[model samples]
Target: MARTLKEATLTTRNARAKLGEGLHWRGIDADTHLGYRKGKRGGVWLVRWRVAEGHYHRDKLGAADDAITEGTLDFNAAVRAARERVEAVRREERAKADGVVHSVRSAVLAYSEMRDARLRERTGSEALRTASSSALERYVTGRVAGGNMEAREAAPIADVPLHDLTEAQLSEWRDALPPTLKASTRRHISADLRAALNMAYRLHRTKLPASFPMTVTEGLHISRKASAEAGEATARENQILPDSKIGEIITAARDVDAAGSWGGDLYRMIIVLAATGARFSQVARLTVRDVQADRSRLMVPASRKGQGSKPEATPVPVGADVLAALAPAIRGRAGGDLLLTRPKMMREPGQLKWVAVGQRPWGMAARLVEPWAEIRKAANLADDVVPYALRHSSIVRGIRAGLPLRLVAALHDTSIAMIERHYGRWIADGLDDLAAAAVVPLVPA
Candidate 1:
């Protein structure tokens, strides 16, 4: 028997209260119906309508007659609200299908694709592309380490709808980032996300809300604070080892080598790092040909910062003593042989093998080893002394030795601006030379 409109429309509370839990005919549309379920407040009315074949979208219309005895909801009004909700959902689904920026995840994906296309076309530098890709990865899959402990377990908001994203939610995510990350790094990541959002709006040509990242600038207060803190920390903690400290570390490295722990390789490696101001990656990739050709200069291959098809043969003037120290490795080795190889270590059951120092487990040749923890402990150096500190020490030593800032920057394959920014205070010590050279006794006026 078919339920009629009169049968479904119960005007009084007492009459509708008799209807039990399950789908009840609304007699409004073929797909529209009222679902009744028991709730804390007696019974609840759920307005459900089929948006597609075998797929229904439902919303809570209001409490049933038993719960809403004072002010009962009319059947006609409830049906109208249900229809409106279904239409809204249909619009959202259609927008999503049409790629009109529905969700944050979708927007990020689209932006990433655009970025990759740009990278493929060589529209941007590799470094910029790499940084942007890293930022995007962190954004989609929340950063695991290097942030505040409280924020370590926060859920990724990649699935969040773009329109539904609130400032409070974004703030929470930003606050949860690793407290250890530099302020500049935090700022960069934020900028990347903002760019992605902007790209989404532009690509989709959708009318974004005024609260979008491009329109809003003041909400990222925590990220800005973190950036400030990082800057302060960098200034305070930039450790450039003194000459005496460098000598002490060298002596410690020699002692470790003499103990047969790993022979004199570490000592030589340290000497090369300090002498040339070359990065660990650059030094590790050197061949016998690089060392044998020039006693005064160590040729650095195309590094992360280097721009060219061929390797950069940087002229870093080294003393004969440094060359003498490296001679043992260069002797009787082919030009193609690695200048520095890992010490022979017992693998399993008396199988001793020498591994390439630059060999990465993942087969990436460009990875640099920072064996600072063990070396620092052996050298009795400060905990803050990192591998890059050797390069800083070298730059400082050159500046203090009265080497021109331009020459030092050239030797290190960097800019005068970078040198000044990082080691400007040390460079100031050599200004007296400039002052002395500039001073000329004035003729009788």
Candidate 2:
């Protein structure tokens, strides 16, 4: 039952006495503040009640003259409002905590409030989120930051609250991704956004929407197996360059004289790729220390996927031409240095100086290759033949030259199974070479 004004006064007086001056206990009707007020007639008990923390203030409800008299202040009405306000506050707190639907902007603010470290720990700190963020920065930010659901934006669903994301909404956004995105690339975006949302919910459990949803099937219908096959076909087609064309490219590169050295770095880099069968990024990221001059080995410290983990440097030996080509770059190898890399591109612009031993700039290289491609096109070469074709040609040459599968695998720093799967068709008929190299007893020694 609600207290009467007289009852509330008595309660306030007792609470004030216990708590001392200036402190008051909360009651249904008001929060009473107690103190002594200096008056013309000396001092008197000054009592006041604040109906709400900042919303309402009442001076003890009744005047000092009426304090000992009627003390009428509609105490019941005040109590009811206070009770309703308290319940409303409780509801808001519960809704926020329970992950009820919030505006996208509000949800974003809540997500940003969590510390990165805390969120990572709670979500197990998967590296994919970092990669996803990179893709987002590249594609999503510029378009969406302008506050438009522009059709050109990749993954428009990211603009919606993660918790409120539904399959239909995801589908709409999926349809909005660039038409050029391969199924694999689309899948990657889906997985990336999923990881981000999942992490948000896990780390900020109390603040996320209670029923967040996602679906990878929204935009594309290509199966993972089909995508893998397409990728494999692409890889195989890339590696099937003619030996005659390879000789022509070599000739084109060698035509550059030492006085100019226009094609020197470009030529040598291509030779290394062919001989080493290293991924373009792998070759680009190589530090001086990664090369073993004495052993003619190309060491890959880590793949793009396995970076920040332990370095997995695999050593693959190269032929003399490649050794000679690379010799210029490795001329004065000091202890502990990068053999090759495009660190200039990796580092933030304006933060580092350009160095010869630094990493290769992939974009710049690709642009440079345009003229090369035009030259090849003039020669009626296949359009798919690229710098990576050197790597593939080297593998094919190794198999054709009667190298053992194990040795080929070692030279390429890949599995025997991979060598067989990729180049076995070209080498399968050459088992006679394998037989010739097989252990045959010359004598019973």
Go through the candidates in order and give each one's C-alpha lDDT: 0.63, 0.52
lDDT string for model 1 (1-445, tens) is: 4334333544445655666644455544777766555444566567777777776677887765565555645555555666766655654564577565466667766777676665544322333334566566665544456545223332477776765566776676667667777777776666666667666766554444544653324444434355444554332244678778777777777776666555567788778888787777577767778874455767765455523354356767777888888888888879987676646444555657543343211111122234556567877777776778888878877887888787888777778987876666677767876678889989987
Q: Candidate 2 regions off by >4 Å? A: 1-156, 166-172, 175-222, 228-232, 236-238, 242-244, 256-263, 306-311, 333-337, 340-368, 374-380, 394-445
**Candidate 2 per-residue lDDT over residues 108-222, each given as its tens digit:** 3343334334335433433222345445445443334555534344345445654445667656655676777876687676555444455556655554435543242343233
The superposed Cα distance between candidate 1 and the true structure at residue 88, in angstroms, equals 17
Estimate the Cα RMSD of every predicted model relative to the unseen true structure. 12.5, 16.9
Name the lDDT value of residue 325 in candidate 1.
Answer: 89
Clashing pairs in 1: 146-178, 147-177, 147-178, 147-179, 148-178, 148-179, 183-227
For model 2, state the Cα shift of residue 422 in Å: 6.9
Alpha carbon lDDT at 127, candidate 2: 29
Number of clashing residue pairs, candidate 2: 12
